[model samples]
Target chain A: MNERYSRQTLFPAIGEEGQKKIRKKHVLIIGAGALGSGNAEVMTRAGIGKLTIVDRDYVEESNLQRQQLYTEEDVFEKMPKAAVAEKRLRAINSETDIAAVITDATPDRLEELVQTVDLIIDSTDNFETRMAINDISQKYQIPWIYGACVGSYGMSLTIIPGMTPCLHCLLKKIPIQGMTCDTGGIIAPAVQMVIAHQTAEALKILVEDWDAIRTTFTSFDLWGNQYTNIKIAKAKDDGCLSCGEARTYPFLQNENLMKTTVLCGRDTVQVRPPAKQQLDLARLSEQMQASGYQIKGNPYLISVEMKPQRIVVFNDGRALIHGTKDLSQAKAIYNRLLG
Target chain B: MNKLLFFAHLKDEAGAETLSIDVSGKTIAELKTIVSEQHGLTKIDSVMTAINEEFAEDDDIIQQGDTIAFIPPVSGG
Candidate 1:
């Protein structure tokens, strides 16, 4: 046994025997953003047997702020997150077999990936994607850990097939949280907090420590100084489309094709502020320049290139994000560059 | 006095995360009407509720001194 894992193996819960089990399980991680990056890094270092990460978005300098696995170099090259994750994880633990898939986590794509993995980790930044993952998890009976964070708030829950209430049951009404990292902003600490909970549960699951896994949906607001372990067993519904007897697997259906954005197909996403208003492009341009960003613009609009995406801001406060169709990610790029 | 907890954007709208309000017999839905008007939280109908740390439904009755928490979904990596 390599001394690299001696400390972990020495732990009573994850002894040498537990370490061996951990080293043999396959894990699939969706999205390679803050949560995904954190989960992958921890699991890779833990010497998981295999990890397959799928991410479609390219790295931006903005990501470097919290996405620990990325650096300025990755942003400069406009590398997709999955590809970059694989490179970094391999360097951290060569013993771990790392595979990266640089494509959208579509329902079909997820079904194929879930077939070979023992567990899934939900690190997506969109509701559609999470639903797709959840349905696939139920259809295949694979356990997955859910994690998300924005600003100083975060949440996580472990879903074991046939044991825990699935994400489908809990989201019958879909808590359409209007804030995204791009809109609400985020903190590194919040991301880490969720990661801590998720990875801890992942370890327990991998070691088959069934009794130790959390049964509650954990949530918190670090800045607000609040923590909660909400009882979610009651949220489990036998009539749930994903986990219910019918097992319709709605998310896996063709109509539920996980489109990155509601207004996708066009590479450019037009973002308008909450209340329609006029935008002073000149002042904003000056602000950008003052903030050390180079810009190109006319009186009507300002076009700024934030690597991997070009944002063109019109005078009416609407901006066109070219190069990606992910609405939340587009907003994030716009906010990071403009604000 | 019922201790109310807000989460995610609700916490932001609340200005304060926890509050003490008198909701002796209001149900979760009825309480939402009151809090939404006060905090300017729109479209909060989908938020989950936990009464005394246990999940509660829309019609679940709220008694005095119960600690209720409103948890909204978070979607960021």
Candidate 2:
């Protein structure tokens, strides 16, 4: 264990006994963005024995402002966020075993990843991923803490599978396209405060101090001087799609997912569905005919051609929508029409 | 009459942590217009309306003594 945790261990609640337990626990943190960086740093320093850091995106200059793990050199190298965080965390505390996985958390990947860790901590930027994690945690009966931030505010909640209400219990349904740091612009302090709370709750859980973990969802704003705690002790609602019926709606199972690539200098879009789903070739060709599109390829991989718009669909329900710079809008379109 | 509790940015915009609005046999949409008239919320896209801590749909009816809230999009970890 790291000597840096000695001061924290001195506390009666987390004495040597608790420190030992903490050192044996393995925590998995998803998302190596702002919140994940702070969380990984704190947990590693606090001497959590094993750490698994996962993130898909690489570090960029914009991330240095609040993502405490990466440096200018890392941004220059264009290293993945999880890899950068693992390198920094190893320097911070070699006693903690740090492993980095650079990949997106789709439903297929989650089943493999969730089984390896004792707990899950959310640092995802979007609601879809967060809800996915929430569902996975509840299904596996594993504890996961949800954390998020934007502007000068942050929020956190400790979800202990069977004990407290999960994320769906607190918010009846997903909000209608909430704003993000990319849109709203977040500050550094707000990220830190929420990460601090998550790390604290994580510590309590790691130390096996179930009594010390917070039961309510907490929110605060650094610039606004506001603090509020929403109680979520209620049982999972029967109406909730995920937690209510214990249904594990795997996101990867959705046929709308597409694997696409943009042509070197061409603009187009492509979409494909699984082999079992009828493609309605006549109907699809009719819709594309008006747009001057040519349908090509066999049933395995359908290639659609239009004036400047191009799209490709595979048998496994993969797609590539071209001519658009925004990925969210593309995914939304896929979900709307194909899902 | 109903009590409306605000959290995060909604609380900041309202300038008060908590307040009340009187509405009898009114739908949430109608009450929103009344509240907007007083609070000058001519543009209402950013905030989400909830009743008793649960999100309320636009057509959901609002009765007296119900707890109403306007929640701004929040960010926290």
Candidate 3:
């Protein structure tokens, strides 16, 4: 065992033998936001073998409040979250192989990554991505931990495929008027509390301690001073569309995926055109420049400043339309500018 | 009295985390209507019902001292 992990190895539950298991495990974290960054730091320090951190956003000044892995320099440089996270995580534990993927978590991308990872951690801020993670977990028979927090409340669930109830069995659909971090706001303590539970679950799974894993849906409100652990082991619906006997995997299906989404807490909307369309950033930049739009970009992305709203387009036919969260208005901008 | 609990944004909508209502033999649907009227929540239908930490259907009967939680969807990470 590495001298750095000596303290962890001293722990009885993850003594030398269990530490060996953790040293050989691979974890794929979906988002690089608050929960994702926190989980990455904890898991990396715990000596996980390989970590793949994926995110589609860049570091912002506001992110410094709760996202611990980033610094003011990263925000000033407008660094892509995955890359900065990978750099920080590598410095934390060089022995762990870290891969920073800069792209959205579409079903096809998740399918390819799931084949290589042992487990997944859900730290995304949208229901669409959570549904996708649930589908991938069920279809591949891999285990996943779902964690979310907003305001002073946090909730989490562990889905072990056939053994426990998946997220769908818990909440059939996202409430139409559900509040997001953007609308409702969030506290740093809540994010820390949720990630603490998630990282502990991740460690148990990596150490192959199935018995120690939590089987209930756990939630707590710090300000309200309330905690609830609802038994969700029996909530597994045999007729569930995602994890049922037939295993429809509707979220993984191409038709069910959204092409555009209003990002939470950012007042931005993301537009993902069909996968078949490969965007030519150079050509788009030339056209935008000709139209008097100030454009700046590298090979991966191009940003166009159009007065109040700025549009950043990626190579994979995805655009982040800033200054608005209306899906219809974003779609209209994408159609007029990119199409 | 049935103890009704609200979590996340549901707490914001209800203006309280918990409330005690003097109703017995009322189904989850009937309870939702009464609670919505009392709390002035327009989206009561979207809140999921759980009886004593177990998810219950709209038709599930609410008995005295039963703890019901109205949970709205949470999507923050």
DockQ of candidate 2 (2 decimals)? 0.23
Second chain TM-score per prediction? Answer: 0.91, 0.75, 0.88
If chain B of candidate 3 is superposed on the true chain B, what is its TM-score? 0.88
Per residue, candidate 1 scores C-alpha lDDT tens digits across B1-77 of 99998887687678887899899798999999999898766656767789998888788899989999998876777
**Clashing residue pairs in candidate 3, if any?**
A182-A265
| lDDT (tens digit, per residue) of candidate 2 on A1-339 | 346777987798999998988888889998898999998999898888899887777887978899998899998998888988998899999899998998877666777888867888888775556777888887788899989887787788898876777776655444432445644568999998988899889988887899999876676777868776655554346666566665544333454233334435655444333233434444344444433457777656556653244556555556676666444445434432232
Q: Pick the candidate with the highest TM-score.
A: 1
- Best first by lDDT, ranked: 1, 3, 2
Q: Which residue pairs in candidate 1 have backbone atoms (N, alpha carbon, C) closer than 3 angstroms, thus clashing?
A: A151-A186
CA deviation > 4 Å runs, candidate 1: A258-339
Over the stretch A300-322, how does candidate 3's per-residue lDDT look in tens digits? Answer: 99998865788898888688999
Q: Report per-prediction Cα RMSD to one decimal.
A: 6.1, 9.1, 9.8
Q: Each prediction's Cα lDDT score? A: 0.83, 0.70, 0.82
Between prediction 1 and prediction 2, the one with superior TM-score is 1
lDDT of 1 by residue, A1-339 (tens): 679999899899999999999999999999899999999999999989999998888898878889999999999999989999999999999999999998777788897888879889998887667888888889898999999888899999899999999988886744442456765678999999999999999999999999998999899989888889998888888889999888898877775442223345677877664434456677667656654566899999998876678888878756788888777677556544433
Q: Give, for candidate 2 chain A, the lowest lDDT window spanning 10 residues.
A: A269-278
Q: What class would a CAPRI assessor give candidate 2's docking?
A: incorrect
Interface RMSD of 1: 2.8
